[model samples]
Target: MTVICEECGKVYHVDPDKLDRYKGKNVRVRCGECGHVTQMSRLMDAAEEPAYDFEKAAAPSMPSAAPPQREMPEEPAPRPDIAYRTAGTEGRAGWLGLRGKMVILFLVIPILLLAISGYLSQQLLRQMATDITDESTELVLQEGKEKLMQKARDVAKQCEVYLQNHPTLEREDFFYDPEFSMLAVQVVGESGYTCLIQQPEPERGQNWTIWAHPNPNIIGIDDIDMIRKALGPHFEDFFKVLGASEGMRESDGNYMWKDPDGKIREKYMAVAPINLEGLPFLLMSTAYIDEFTAKTEYLKEYANNKTAEIRNINVGVLLIVIIIIGLCILIYGYRLTRSIQYLTEAADRISVGDLEAEIDIKSKDEIGNLADAISRMQDSLRFSIERLRRRR
Candidate 1:
């Protein structure tokens, strides 16, 4: 397309694509030939012209017949190389830029850190509970063992008195006394008793006999075989108590046994000697380790509740901190991005020959400095352009 500049009257070729922007309107542009400013108007001719195929018009209706001449397609109009571009406009809204991406990362990092912190805190709380559980169990076991030893000694003294009061009674008859049998049966824990065992009677060709037992069903039964089978790992410990009671007034020993509740735990046996003239019997008490710390379940429940509370509070606080930090970063980033948007639009207008476009923002940052520099550059460009026109 050819257009004559109104100012310079210089005829120049202008691609129709550039004039497409001025459809039904006038736009001013500097003439490439003489720097003369000219106003050009173009109408897009929107009257909806019907498209015609030139090949069809020239081909004629020929079926399976060779055509004499080939028609060539018309050449397309050349597009303009000069396009009006606003600086930063093409990339502003659709995708995240470097500045926006950095801001997003800054906000997200804190949330991840807080999540890790919350997990670590919960583990610490559970570990502390386990420690407290172990420590309290040990303390109660020690105290219970001491009390059990003292109780055995008291029962030994009562046995000595019972022997002395029944002076005429045979040792065998006294051990099976109905009053003593009732006392032994009433006692609990570890399924044991403070009773007598007699060595083998050579006169009857019999092995050692259980003179008495807390369980009446085992009374007058053979002691050795039954004791070993019933006691399991405790069989040796029982014999140790039987032999050691002759010398030591009191002693303590350990064995493994299942409790009435069906849990296997350590059982401590306390043995004390009853000093009877000719017949010696050992007074014994067996107590399970768990019996000492009966409050363990309560303690554990309380600890769990308290740990849950602390974990809840810790999580709540961490979430609050993360939210506050994220909000602050988001708000700060939004303000910074808004200021940059203003500078971008101003720069965009300047790039398209709108030198009078005001940056309009006053700030004490690098962005503000850049705005001042661009304004100066605009003035410089206008001055240089005017000087060139005057020289021309």
Candidate 2:
């Protein structure tokens, strides 16, 4: 499109694409020839007028002896160069520059990923701790049950030998005789004891009777109902083990036992039948199962504390990593953006014919290479201008 200086009638050729943004609006432009500001209308596709021929209009009026007049220097033509630019007249809000974008890419995204990894690691650690505790508890219980069964068998053998030596000792008189009662009642473990009980025989009017026991009140009596009342729902397990004693088979089981303080605790019991003829007595040993797994409980608590400590350390490490990354990006991004700003200002100055603009950026990275290239271009422009000045 053509724009004519209304003051000097000088014609200027303007790219139609440059006026696209001002479509349907009035715009003003300063003429390069006469500096005359002209208001252009939105109807940009007007017919091109014939260019005013200044040379032809002046030549006919000049004499052959007249000297030529020097013309004023023309302003440099505008070039559409796409480059990193700052805000013009129209600045956008919340615009993230290169540094801000870099922080999001290098710092924020990595921190999120680290947080996710840390969460998953803690969950996995908790699951592994739970599994190890369960397996260790089971292993200790198995070993304890075997030891308890062996202890019951050994005590049963001792009772059979003692009863064989005193063949005339009756079940009713066993608790009264101190020597026989001592042999029948033995200590099994810490807070546990072994006792003798007779198998049930309904035809002879006999029931589950305690012939010898650590407690004198329960000796030489039918204590089955009292035990059942104390055990409540847990009596079935104890009864099953006792019933198997009549078949001459060793029986071992676990059951809940209520203590004097109203605390319900799990207990392990083992029963071993006596081999003596005409003797329907069996030796039973019982103790709390917690006594065997006490060490395992301590170890589990220790593991939980250590796991919590390790998790704290992991959280600290993650925070430290994020801080380090943030600091690095801030330091490096600031330096990098400052160097680019220096190059931008230098380039802007050089574009306006200021060939003396200094570009002092020096580093070992790509930005340094760019600074060197721009410095060479500046030197070249200076050389070209000096050469042109000398020729003139």
Candidate 3:
């Protein structure tokens, strides 16, 4: 026969033959687990009815040999249902519980999102700063190129007018005349100048030559090899722009040039034709592009530094925010779950007939309302239990 303790739900197995002695009498057995008394006479009547052939076979052949006493077995194994309930309770003892899940949901997940957002924001700031710097540099370079070209055209026109006024001025005596040399050659920017150079005419056996220049040694040069030796690998790019001045049209480009100290630097060149009947000379204005873009470079560097500084500040602020959020969740969740734990323990006590369990929650939140309701229910249960006891 199987008997269960009502208060604690601990199951016990009773020998059917031992129960036959108290079959029709008011006998009771005390549960060893909880000491709750269970009347065996009611179970004995049910045990007498055979619901299956197996029970009838297991029963004692003679009822006169039954024991005179009814008692619980010394050791009883819990049923499968009891074991399953215990295992279920143990499963919730780890991080799968409510508090662990709340940390993951409100703290861990939010911090991950904040980190991702901060990374993307920093990347966007860097890209925007780079784009602005590139655009500003381009605008400054374009304006510089236009201004340099205009200066070359104006100087070329002035030289043509001066040469036409002096019709008898010979090519060999051009640089010797101070007034004509000053009109033909002039300074451009820092380490830059305008000079007169005629295009190569193989039909006349005259190579590309510089007629008037600031440097006296460079003037009247028709040797291509000497020019190539001076310019190095950048000779082709320089002449390419200079050659584009054919048909009396204007042309301009950039090329790397070797300075007197053998250092290489990027220089811009603008060519404008000097239309003096027989002279087919061109005025070339050349200057280092860095001269006009220095302020732009500085601004770009400033913008990049500012962007990095702002990104660092944002990262610090993000870390602070994550820390603050984590602290709030920890403190708030601890208090919230602590209150819940108290209510749960009180409910457990009430379920076990310990109506004296106190709910000390004082907050006027939903938890407080729930505590009040449970307190009322506990009072009603105590009152009903008291009334039943009085009647008994």
Q: Estimate each model's TM-score.
A: 0.66, 0.75, 0.74
Q: In candidate 3, what are the lDDT values of residues 171-219, reduced to their tens digit?
A: 7777888998898788877777888888777687776788888889867
Candidate 3 Cα lDDT to native: 0.76
For model 3, state the Cα shift of residue 115 in Å.
Answer: 3.4
Candidate 1 lDDT, tens digit per residue, 309-362? 988898888778877877777787777788887788777666656666677768
Which digits, one per residue and each the tens of the lDDT, describe model 2 over residues 1-392? Answer: 66655456455666767776653465566666555455666575656443445434533467868787554344334432222233332234257988999899999998999889989999899889988988999999898888888888888898888878888878888888888777777776677778888888778898889988888998867888998999889889878777777766678888888898988898998999888876677888888999888989998998899889989999999889988999999999999988887787777656645566578877879999999999899999779766854553
List the lowest-lDDT window of 10 residues for candidate 2: 80-89
Which ten contiguous residues of candidate 3 have the minimum total lDDT? Answer: 79-88
C-alpha lDDT of residue 164 in model 3: 87
Model 1 residue 177 CA deviation (Å) reads 4.6
Computed on alpha carbons, the lDDT of every model, listed in order, comes to 0.64, 0.77, 0.76
